[model samples]
Target: MNTIEQQLWEYIDGDLDEFSKKAIEEKIKSDARIKVQYEELLKLNSAFSALDLDEPSMSFTRNVMESIALAPAPVAMKTKVDKKIIYAIGGFFIVSLLFLFGYSIYSSNLSMPKLDFNFNFNLDRYITPTVLYSFLFFDLVIGLVFLDQFLRKRINKEH
Candidate 1:
C-alpha cells in the first residue's frame, strides 16, 4: 500500500503516533485525492460501526452442546490379536515349509521305487486318506479365503 493509504488506515484504527497523525492531517489538507479517500474511508467505517451483526437462533448453542453430549463415546474398531500366537504360528509354518523343501531336495537324489515284473506297486507307502483329507481341507480353506477377498474387492469396486 502507498504511504498515504497506510497512514490513513493507521489513523482510522487509532494506531498513529502524534507526529505521524499531524503529518497525515497536513497531507490530507494539502492533497484533494487523499482528502476524498479519507472521507470515503470515514463513511465506510461509520457504516460498518452502525451495522448490526447477525446472531444464530437462541437454541443454536444449546443444540450444539446437546448434540455433543448425545454423541457416542469412541472405541477402537479393530481388536488386537496375540502377537505370540501369530509369531509362533508363522515360525511353525516357516520351519515346516523349510523342512519339507529341504527333505524333498535331499530325497530327490535317491532312486525311485520300481514296479516288479508283476507290475504291482504299493501306493499306500506314499499317500493315505489322512493326507488326502488334510490336503483337501487346506485347499478348501485357501479357496474360501481367495473367494472372500475377491468378492470383497469386487463389492468395494462397485461401491
Candidate 2:
C-alpha cells in the first residue's frame, strides 16, 4: 500500500500516534490536496455509517421458517457415553502397548537381520553412512514439511 493510503487508514482508525496525528493535522490544514483527501475520507466514512446493510431476499425468512417447521422439534442431544469406561479402555490399550514393547525389547538383541541374496548387487558400492544419513534427513524434512502443510490446511479450514 502507498504511504498516503497507510496514513489515511491509520488516521481513520485513530491509530496514529500523537506526533504523527499532529503532523497529519497540520498537513491537512496547510495543503489543499491533503485537505481535499481528508474531506473525501470523512465523507466516505459518513456515507458508510449512514448506509444500511443489504437485506436478504424476500423469500429468505419464508425459506428459513419453512425449514424450521419441517425440521424435527428441538431436542437436546445429551451423550449417554460413560467417561470412566472410556478412560479405562484407554488405560488398557496404553498398558498393553507398554507391556508388549517392554517384552520385545527384553527378548531381542536389536540386531540387524542377515540377508542371504542369490545375486550380488554390490549394495556396498552405493550404501554408505553419509548416504544413509542424507536419506534419513531428506525423509525427515519431507515428513516435517508434509506434516506442517497438513496442519496448516486443517487449522485454516472453516468450521
Candidate 3:
C-alpha cells in the first residue's frame, strides 16, 4: 500500500505518536482524497467490529481430544537394548560350556585309549550332486529371506 494508506491505518489504529497523529489529522482535513480514504477505512473498521464471530460448539474441544486419543501411538524406531548385557550373557554361557567340557576331559583318566583319526568317509552315498545343489538352493532362499527382512527394517528406520 501507499505511504498515505499506511499512515492513515496507523492513525486509525491509534498507533501513531501525538505529533504524527496531529499531522495526519491536518492532512485528512485538508486533502479530499485522504479524507475519502480515511472515511472508507473507518467504515471498514466499524464493519469488521460489527461482525458476529462464529464460535465452535461447546463439545468442540472434547471431540478433538477424543479423536486425538483414538489415534494409534507412534512406535520408536530404535529402542535401547544394551548390547553389552547381551554379549555378557552369551560369553558366560560359552565360557561355562568350555569349562564343563574341559572338566569332563580332565576327570576322564589321563590313560585314555588312542583312537584312529583316519576314517573311510563315503560322501557320494549321502551327499549326491542333487542333494548338494538343493542344500545350496535352500541356503540361498534362507539368505534372501534374511536380506529382505534386514532391508525392510532399514527402510522402516529411515522413515
Candidate 4:
C-alpha cells in the first residue's frame, strides 16, 4: 500500500487510478495524521480560490488620460509641401542658376593658352536642377495642404 503522504499528493492533483483512490480512502479511515494533513491542504486550496475580484480606482483611467494629454500633443501635424514656399524657392534657384550660367559663359571667353581639352555635355547639370526644383514644389504643395487641413480642424474645434 502507498503511504498517506504520497496518496494525498496524487489525490490533490487528481491523478490517482480508481483502485488506488479507494485504497487511500480506506487507509484515511484508520489514519488521523493523513486526515488532518488532507483537511489542511483542502482549506488552503479553498482560501486561494476565494480572492477578491474588485476593480482598480476610477482615477486610474483619468490619470492615464491626463498623462497622455500632458505629453506635448504632437508637433501640430506639419506637411511635406507648402506651395508659396516652393514657388519662392524654385524662383530663387532658377535665378541663381541663370546667374551661374552667365558667369560661366563670361569666364569661358577669357584668353587661354592653347590646351587640348574637349567639353563634355553633362545631361546631369540640366536634369539635376529641374528635378530638384520640381520635387521642392511638390513637397511645398503637400505641406500647405496639410497645414490647411490642420488649421481647419483647429478652427472647427474652437467653434
Which has the greatest TM-score? Answer: 1
Candidate 4 stretches with Cα past 4 Å from truth are 1-3, 52-159
Instruction: Answer with 2 or 4, whichever has the higher TM-score.
Output: 2
C-alpha lDDT of candidate 1 relative to the true structure: 0.77
Extract clashing residue pairs from model 1: none
Q: Cα lDDT for residue 122, model 2?
A: 44
Off by over 4 Å in 2: 55-159
Instruction: After the best TM-score superposition of candidate 4, give how far the Cα of residue 140 lies from its true spot, in angstroms.
Output: 72
Q: Candidate 2: RMSD over Cα atoms?
A: 16.3
**Per-residue alpha-carbon lDDT of candidate 4 for residues 31-56, written as tens digits (9 for 90 to 100):** 89888988887787678779877898
Please list the Cα RMSD from the true structure of every candidate, rounded to 1 decimal place: 10.8, 16.3, 11.3, 15.4
lDDT by residue (1-159, candidate 1, tens digit) is 888888898899999999998989999999999999999989988999999999999999999999999999899778565576566557657866875675465445444467332433445565566975786687577658756766886797689
Q: What lDDT tens digits, residue by residue, belong to model 3 across residues 116-151?
A: 344344444665669757856865775586567668
Q: State in Å the error of residue 140, model 2.
A: 37
Per-model C-alpha lDDT, please? 0.77, 0.74, 0.80, 0.74
| Residue pairs clashing, model 4 | 81-139, 81-140, 81-142, 81-143, 81-144, 82-140
Steric clashes per prediction = 0, 0, 0, 6
**Model 1: runs farther than 4 Å from truth?**
1-3, 56-59, 79-93, 96-159
lDDT of 2 by residue, 2-101 (tens): 7876797689889999999998888888899878987888888889999999999999999999999999888997756557656755765676587567
